[model samples]
Structure formats: structure tokens, C-alpha cells
Target: MDRVDRIRERKREHLELALTEASQSRRASGWDDVALVPSALPERSLGDIDLSAELVGHRLRAPLLIVGMTGGHPDARMINKVLGAVAEAHGIAVGVGSQRAALEVPELAPTFASVRDHARTVPVLANIGALQLIAQGERPALGAEKVARLVDMVRADAIAVHLNVVQELLQPEGDRVTGPLLPALAALVRVAPVPVIVKETGAGIDRESARRLVDAGAAALDVGGVGGTSFARIETERAGVGEGPFADWGIPAAASVLECRGLGVPVIATGGIADGATAAKPLALGASLVGIGRAALLAANDGVEAAILTVGRLIDELRTAVLLSGGARPSDLMARPPVLTGATEAWARQRGLLA
Candidate 1:
């Protein structure tokens, strides 16, 4: 296969394996250790709750984002269409997978661009890897001009620059060079017409990294923490290797959320969020939005209605969780602090995030 064909094959493999149980991390996301205090007299009813939230200057009916997961292959076109339709129907946000593949082969542009056709109103984020900001092998860095095509192709409301160092290290054909990424990111932020969101790819973001990203002009941060679909494991599997020590590595989702919170910009808690109750934890912990990855992907695979139903159920459960916690909105959960236990609490203590 040629280089473009190899990239397409890789993208197809990722889509197939991501939905399997083997791609999931065995470690806990720290949500299980968190318990919200129930109220005896929650005066507000579920019907009165408001799920609306704002991110990157766009208002959304719900604070849920269908995290970028697929693109660059023929099959990915329909998946993007389904996900985009679901997002538009629910008034939530959606993001496409890395547009690097399309940039290499213009023919695949339709696969990623399909999102804009259905998700006309909601915020659509265009994705690219941090490695693409620097030159690798014979390929030159994707400078300001090429990056603009990424946004134009998706009609993106924002750009999500994903940081996937671990995945790159494991993948056979991954970009191995570690150049001056911060400066490139800063330059991209200066030139891009839309907000630039720096996101992790399962390893999660720490307080120090979050600070630097914010300093580099990252409009938001997606703490794609551990305890979810682990790309490390996926790469290993693709390489014919079994799960290694790094399979369950990185900061858990809950702790990462605490670490990323208090920063001025909005934080998106991603990792292993599976249900509405689980999603509510991050929102209460100061995350402006929650991201659904494998679950949404699986639902979309079943078709548009399934995707909508799955998202609708999760949103309903989120509203219910907030109501039971004596809150009229999702943000109210922050005031009623959760009682943390297990490894999650230990992490918070060591990180000095817990007082």
C-alpha cells in the first residue's frame, strides 16, 4: 500500500477496535469512588432543570460533546453523518477525527466534511494531532495555510489540537519526533480563525501541562483522562503485542478533572465517561462539558436513531442526578461536594488538589 492507503488502513483499524472491550482500560476512571450527597428536600423537580451550557462562545442545549473519533476512510463518512445528525438533533457539539489523513489525500476530504452537512447549528470541532505541528521524516510541518484548510473542510467552529504522545510512541507508523511543540501551538493560535482547544488522548492532563497550554493560548482543555478507551492498548494490539504496563497508565478521569479545574478556560472531562450520572461528576467538579467517545461511536454504529436514543438517555439521567443532588442545574453539584474514596482520593491528596 502507498502512504495514503496505509493511513486509511490504520484509520479503519482504529474504528473497528475502538468499539471492542479489549480497547478499554482495566483501570477505574475514579468516578466510582465519588458519591454525591443526596438531599432530603430537593425542592426543584426534574422538569425545571436546565441543561444548557456554553463553550467557546457557543451555547449548547446540553454540555455533551461527541468527542472526535473517526475519519479518513470510506466507512467513516456514514459514521460522521450519523454522529452529526445526532448532535444537530440534540443541540450538542461534535468533533471529527484527525484531518491529517485527508490533508495527505484530498479524495478523503468528504469523509470528514460530511459532519458539516448535518451538524449545521452545533459547534463542530476540527481535529489534528500535536505531532503534525512539527516536521516528521520527509513531511514538512502543517503550517498556518494547511491548517486553515482543516477548518474550512469541516466548517469548524473550533479546532481541537490533540496531544497523543503515548499513542505515537506505540504505533508502528507514528510520528516519533518531539520538536518545539509549544511555539508551534502558539503560532497556530495566533493564525487560526477559531478557538484552539488542546486535548489529551487518554493519558490525561496535569496542572502543570494545563497551565502551559493555557499560557500557550489554548482556549479550552479536554482532559482525556484514563479509565476509558486506551489508544496505547489499541496500538499494541495492532502491532500484534498484548497489553503492556502502559495499558492502564496515566491519570484517572476524576483526578485529572480536579487538576484541570480552576483554570480560567473551560475544561472538558473526557476519559471513560459512560453514562449520564458519570458525566455529571465532571460537570459538578467544574468541567464545562462532558465527552462521550466509545459509547457514542457504538451507538452511531447501530445507526442514527440508536445514537440519538443513547445520548437522550444519558442526558435524562444527568438531569435526574442533578435533581436528586438538590440542584436545579448541572453546575449546582459543585456546591454539594462529593465524598471521594479509593485511589481517586489518594491522587487528589498527593496532587494537593484536595484541601
Candidate 2:
């Protein structure tokens, strides 16, 4: 098969493998390690608790983002449509998978565009790989012009430049050399119409890198840390190989949120965020938003109604969590500290993040 065909095949494989149990990280995502201190006497009712949140100037009915999952294939079109419809109905943010495939093959553009086509009212995030921003061997760098086209293609409210270094390395036909990524990213930030959000695919970003990205004009950060979908594992599975040593590699989601927060940019805590309670943990740890991946994908697979049902459950649970923790809104969790233990606490202590 040619490069385009290979990409299409890989996209299909990713959708399939990600749903399997083996593709999930065996290691904890640190949500389990962080506990919210319950309010024995709650002052507010559940209806009074607000889940609405704002990120990069976009107001969301819930502090939840349906993290970018798929696109670039015929099958993905329906998936994006379903996810977009769900996000539209809820007034939340939604993202599309990397637009590289659609960029290379214009015929596939509608696949990713489906998100914006359906979710007209909410924020839509356009995606591109971190490595694509710079020259990689024979391939030319996707400079400002093409990058701007990505935003236009989806009418994206913001652009998400995904950092997937490990996923690239694990894939059979991956780009190896990531040349001077920071400067190229800074250049993109200069010309891009909307806010630039530097996101991780699965591996999390460290404090140093997070600070640098923020300095480079990143409007936000999606700490797509380990513990959710292990793209490394998914690639390995696609390669028909065993679960390698790097299967559970990278910082946990909870730790990554702590690392990225307070850097003067909003952090979207992703990875291993399965439920509203799990989603609440990151917010209490200072994350401005929580991203749901695998769980959303599973629900979308069942159809739009099923996905809406899942989202409703999550929103309800999130409201309950905020109320039980003595909060009236999602942002309130940020001030109402959570008790950190296990590796999450150790990570905070060692990183000097714990006060």
C-alpha cells in the first residue's frame, strides 16, 4: 500500500485496538491516588453546583472536552458526526484527530470536517502532530499556510498541536527526527488565528517543557498523560508485537496536571479520566478542564444517544463530586485541595510542586 493507504489502515487499526483491553495502560493514572476531601456538612444543593467552565475564552456548559479521537477515514466520518452532535447538544468542546491524513488527501477532508459541521455552537479544536510542524527527512514541514488551512477546514475555535513523540517512535512508519520543534511552534503561534494549545497524545509533558510551551505563546495545555489510552500500546498491537517496555511509560495524568497547572495557562487534564469522579480529581488538582477519550469513544461507538447518555452520567457525577467536596462549581475544586497519596504525592514531593 502507498503512504495514504497506510495512514488510512493505521487510523482504522487505532480505532479498533484502542477499544481492546490490551491497549489500556496497566499503570495507574494517579486519579486513584488523589482523594477529594468530603464536606461533612454541605452548604449547597446538587442543583446549585455548576459544571460550566471556560477555556481559552470559550464557555462550556461542562468543564469536559471530548478529546480528539478519530478521523481521516470513511468509518471515522460517522464517529466524528456522532461525537460532534453530542458535544453540540451539551455545549462542550470537541476535537478532531490529526488532520495530516486529510491534508495529504483532500478527499478525506470531510471526515475531520464532520466535527465542525455538526458541532456548530461549541468550540472545535483542529489537530496536527508536533513533528509535522518541522521538517522530517524527505517530508517538508507543514508551515504557517497549511497550518492555517487546518483551522479553516474545521472552523476551529483553537488549534491543538499534539506532541506524540513516543507514538511516532513506536509506529512502524513513523517520523523520527523532530527538528527544532519549539521555534517552529512559536512561529505557528505568531501566525495562527486562534489560540494555540499544545497537547500530548498519551505521554505527558514535564514542568520545564510546559513552561517553555507557555512561553512560546501556547494559550493552553492538554496534559494527555499516561493512564488513559496508551497509543504506544495501540501502535505495538497494530504492529502485531508484544506489549513492550514502554507500554506504561510517561508521567501519570494527575502528576502531569500538577506539573502543567499554575504556568499561566489553562491545563486540560486527559488520560485515564474514565468518569465524572475521575474527571473531578484533576480539577481539584488545578486542571481547568478534563478530557475524556476512551470512555467517549466507547459511547460514540454505540451511537449519538448512547454517547449523550454517557455524557449526562458523567456530568451528573461531576455535579455530585463538586457538591460532596463543598463546591458550587468546577473551578471551586481548584481552591478546595485534594489529598494526594501514593505515586501522585511522591511525584509532587519530588518535583517540589507540593506546598
Candidate 3:
């Protein structure tokens, strides 16, 4: 393999290992502070709860979304294939890992493309890094003319512009990050033909920034919040490195969803979402959908069927949550009365949002 490909594989391995071990760590989303109060009165049946959700004009069969995991490397292709097959089986949306590798290495395109190949029914979003595109320099100034071409290559339903500064700063072989990022995003949103989604890798986007992103034409937002897969911590374990107390540095998935609500853009909750209850929390916090990454990877390792089954269980839980709350659909879960106390409550109240 070439030097870049080899380096990519190494990083992928590190991410896989770190995520597998994350649950054992002290880090938690502090969800203990937010409780979804149980209903005592008459309620609907779980089987009737509609998991359908609308995102970027497409309707997803389930409220659970498969967050972007590995790609670009050879091993990642197989994983993506497994993930895509399952996503299609369940009729849920999926996101491909950072497509920077495809933009660089031509041979890598098919692996990422396998998503559309395997999952024709679900929406497949292509992912790219803001920093990487910016490093391309004159590309955006030229109207990102080639950007749509790249997205089309994989039949991406939408394009995810992921903000991964923490991961970048963590890796020794990482790229540079300069500030004043809004203009470039605005350009991508205007230039790219498909809908543009602004996403965080782990650190969630806050209210003020979400408002600006919406103004700049972000069709949707993925709050890849903290409490799951601390990319900073992942890098630290990989290189025995630290970004000086930046390990737990991000907004939890629950809080980020609440913080960025009503920005004129659809919001997705990500990070620290492993099971059905965790996945449902984001929906309760006003997220259009909930995303799970690390859990899928862990499930994939056991085999594709197992991975899909794991996701299916989470979906079942989401439906149950909606029914128990006397709601008929996944969106209704967002409006349920969830009692909040402690840190999660404080996080919500700090932003003047506790619903």
C-alpha cells in the first residue's frame, strides 16, 4: 500500500479499538440527569409507533440513523458494505465515512460507493471534511464545481460537511485547521447541487452557530455530540497523546440537539448513542433523528446480521418509547414530558431549553 493508504488504515484501526473500549471508561453522557418519565394513563401499542422521519426531503423508515464510521481504507469498504446492506434491510439512512480518501485515491471510491450499491432504498450521504476541502485551496473559490461531481460518483442522497477539528488536532499526521470557516461552508451549500448537511464529528454545534449555519444554507445539522467516541480520547490512546484537557471536549449528544433546536434546519443527535434509550434521548431533545456509530462498528465485527439486528432492536426501543409516551410517531417522542435534573438538566437550562 502507498504511504497515505497505510496511514489511513492505522487511524481506522485506532478508532475501532478506542471505540470498543470507550464504554468501560469514566466518560458518560450523564444521561442519568434526564429521565423520560413513564406514562401511567392509557397509551398506544409499541407496534403502532411510526418510526418514519423526514430528513432533507427524504423519508426514513426508522428514527435511527447509521452515523458515519470508517471508509477510505480498504478494510473500511467491507465494513461499509455490511453497514449499507443492513441499512437497506431496515430502510434507514446511512452516512459514509470521510470521503477525502476517494477524492484522493481513485481505487477507494468503490468501497464508499458500495453504500448506494447495497442500499438503494435508504438515503446515503457522502461525507467530507471542511478542513480537507479548505486545504484544497482554490477549489471552493471555483464554485465547488467538482464537488457535485464527487457526490454524484457515489449517488449520495446528500453531502455531509463534517467538522472534525478535534480529531484533526489529535492525530500526529493530521492536517491544519484555520478559523473563519463560515464562508467556505456557505460556498459549498450554494455550489453543491444536493442538500448540504453540516455535521460535527463529536463536538456538537451550539445555538448561535446553528443559526448562522442555517442562514448560510445548511439544510440539516448532525450534532455529533460528546459522551460517545471521544475522538480526542481515541487519538490520545492511539499516539499516547493529549491535546491538553481536550479529551472530554464537546457538547453531549442530548444537549447539542436541544441547543441547536429551531435553527431553521433539521437537527440529528449523534455521539454516545449506543442503545435504544440513548438513541431516543436525542429525539426527546428535538432531534429529527438519532445516530449511532460505535455500536454499529462493534456490531459489525460480530457479523453483518448481528449488526443489523442490534440496530433493529434500537428501532424497536424507539417505537416503544413513542407508544409509552402516548405518541403515535417518532416526532411525537420529541414533545414528550421528560423530567430533567442534575447536569443534563443544567445543560438544557443553561441554554434555556428543557423539553
Candidate 4:
């Protein structure tokens, strides 16, 4: 098969693999180790609690985001439509999966563009792989122009450049070069029309990497840490290999959130955020927003209503978490301290991220 066919097949494989039990992480996201202090008397009404959040200059009704998942295939069109509609209905942000396939084969553009068509109001983000940009050769300026076209294709309010070295290493046809990344990312950030969000794909960014990306001009960070969908496990299954040590690799989502603290740019905590209570922990840990990935995918698979209800329930749970923690708004939840324990505490101390 040609590269276009290979891309399409990979998209299908990704969706199918994501649905399997093997793709999920066996460990905790470390949210269990973080506890929010409860209020004796919250003083604020439950109805008064606001979940509004600002991302890349767009105001969302809630601090929740539906992270990128699938595209580059015909089936993905419907999936994006459902996710985008759900996000639009809830006044939240939505990101489409990588547009490389669509870029390579213009016919697939509608698969990603359907997101913008359905979700016209809320912030819709365009996505591209870091390696894909690198593969475009030495001209960083040329890559920037292509990325700008992707933004226009989806009318994206922001663009997410995903770094997935682990996934690439595991994939049979993955790109292996690690050099020339920072400079290329810097060039893209400088020329891209919209705010650029540097993101990870299941292998969380450490403090040093986060600092470098920020320095490279990333406007935001999406810490796609561990304790969630294990891309390693998915790739292993795809390769017909049983579980391996790599399945549980990468920095835990909670630890990654701490690593990104004080970086100035807003952070979107993702990976293994199963429920609303767990989702609230990251906000307190300094993340401006939280991303629900596998959960959203599973819900979308069940049906559009199922997806909407899933998101709605999480939003309700987040609001309840805020009220119980004595906060009147989702943003205020960040001020309320969390008692860190277990491996998360050890990680914070080891990384010097703890106060």
C-alpha cells in the first residue's frame, strides 16, 4: 500500500486498538494520592459555582476539553461530528486528531473539517504530529505554512503539536529522528496564525522538557501523561506482542501536572482522568483545564447521547468537587491545596516540584 493507504489503515487500527482492554493503563494516574481539603462550611451555593475557563483566548463554559483522538479515515468523520457537537452543546473545547493523513491526501480533509462544521462556536483545535513536521524536511518555514493551512482547514482557534516519541518508537513505521525538533517547533510557533499548544501523547513531559517547549514559544501545554491510555500497550497489541514493561512507562499524569507548575503557560492535564473527582485534582495542581480522552472515546462509541451524557455527568461531578472543597468557581479550586501522598509525593520531592 502507498503512504496514503497506510495512513488510513493506521487510523482504523488506532480506533480499534483504543477500544481494547489492553490499551488502558493498569496503574493509577496518582489522583488517588492527592486529596483536596474539604470545607466545614462552603458558604457558597452549589448553583453559584462556575466552571468557565479561558483557553487560547476562548472562554469555555467549563474547564473540560475533549482531547484529540481519531481522524484520517472515513469512519472518523462521524466520530468527529459527534464529539464536536457534544463539545459545542456544552460550550467546551474540542481537538481533532492529527491532520497528516488529510494533508497528504486532500480527500480526507473533510474528516477533520467536520469538527469545525459541527462545533462552530467553541474553540476547535487543529492537530499535527511533531515527527510529521520534521519529515517535511529542513525548511521549518515550509512546515509552518502547511500547519497554517491545517488551521484554516478546521478554522482552528489553536493548534496542538503533539510529541509522541514513545509511540513513534513502538510503531513499525514510526519516525526515529529526535534532532531538529526544538528549532522546528520554534519556527512553527513563530509563524503559526493561532496560539500553539505543545502536547505529549501518553508519555508525559518532564519539567525540563516543559521548560524547553515554553521557551520555544508554546502558548500552552497538554500533559498527556501516564495512568491513562497506554499507547505502548496499544502498539504492543498491534504488533502481536503481549504486555511488556513499556506498557506502564512514562511520567504519571499527576506528576506531570506538578512538573508543569509555575511554567507560566496554561496546562491541560490529560491521561487517565476517569471521573470528575479525579479530574478536579489536576486543577488544584495548577492545570488550567483537564482533558478526557479514552473516556470520551468510549462514550462516543456508544452513541452521541452517551457521549453528551458522559461529559455532562463529569461536569456535574467537577462542580460538586469544587463545592465540597469550598470553592465557588473551577478556577478557585486551584487555590485550595491538596494533600499529596504515595508515589506522587515522592515524585514531587524527587523532582523538587513540591513546596
Question: Worst ten-residue run, lDDT, model 1?
Answer: 240-249
RMSD after CA superposition, every candidate: 0.9, 1.0, 2.3, 1.7
TM-score per candidate, in order? 0.98, 0.98, 0.92, 0.96
lDDT, candidate 1, at 55: 75
Global Cα lDDT for candidate 1: 0.92
lDDT of 3 by residue, 183-292 (tens): 88887887887998999987888888888888889999998887777777777777765435887887876677778987667888888777787666667767788788
Off by over 4 Å in 2: none
Deviation in angstroms for 197 in model 3? 0.7
Runs in model 4 with CA error above 4 Å? 136-142
Candidate 1 ranges with C-alpha deviation above 4 Å: none
Q: Candidate 1's error at 51, in angstroms?
A: 0.5
Query: lDDT tens string, model 4, 275-344?
Result: 8988899999889999988888888887788888989999999999999999998778768789999999
TM-score for model 4? 0.96
Model 2 alpha-carbon miss at residue 292, Å: 0.7
lDDT for predicted candidate 3 compared with the true structure: 0.76
Q: What does candidate 2 score on TM?
A: 0.98
CA lDDT of each prediction against the hidden true structure: 0.92, 0.90, 0.76, 0.88
- Give the TM-score (vs. native) of candidate 1: 0.98
CA lDDT, candidate 3, residue 267: 87
Question: Each model's number of backbone clashes?
Answer: 0, 1, 0, 0
lDDT score for residue 273 of model 3: 72
